[model samples]
Target: MMTHPSGLILPESRLSDLMREHPHTIPVFLRHHMVCVGCWMSKFDTVADAVWNYGLDMETFLRELNQSAQSIPPQGTD
Candidate 1:
């Protein structure tokens, strides 16, 4: 439960939890070429785990994820 600047997402946050809570972030993961969307390990892996496995820059990944999370409207909202 590492706290990040975005407050909405953290490095230790699980992929399933993040997607369930903020589906908009799904595109961000895909954009980064992460196969976490439907991966079985997503339930157990954290964002940091995915980033490290994919050899991505932590700051850039977190920034994009946070931006997407912040920009998307709540589900069912007009």
Candidate 2:
């Protein structure tokens, strides 16, 4: 199993909850063309499962997810 970016996300983490908790990550999903962003299955699928189902590599996906998370400043920071 691969490590996720941080508390921001994890492979075993559910996609629906992640998006709801971290809206900033939407770009990462979009960049990868992950339909799970709006897919009903996102509620039940983990990032690991979703990536694999979408034919994506776990490490690469995590990398992009981390990068996108880092790019976005916190809600209070400017």
Residues 1-78 of candidate 1 have per-residue lDDT tens digits of 433444567788877777776788899988877789989888899988998999998888888888887787534312
Which 10-residue window in model 2 sums to the lowest lDDT?
A: 69-78
TM-score of predicted model 2?
0.75
Q: Please estimate how well model 1 matches the true structure, expressed as its whole-model Cα lDDT.
A: 0.78
- Compared with the true structure, the alpha-carbon lDDT of candidate 2 equals 0.72
Stretches of candidate 1 above 4 Å error? 1-7, 74-78
Q: Report how far off residue 19 is in candidate 1 (Å).
A: 0.9
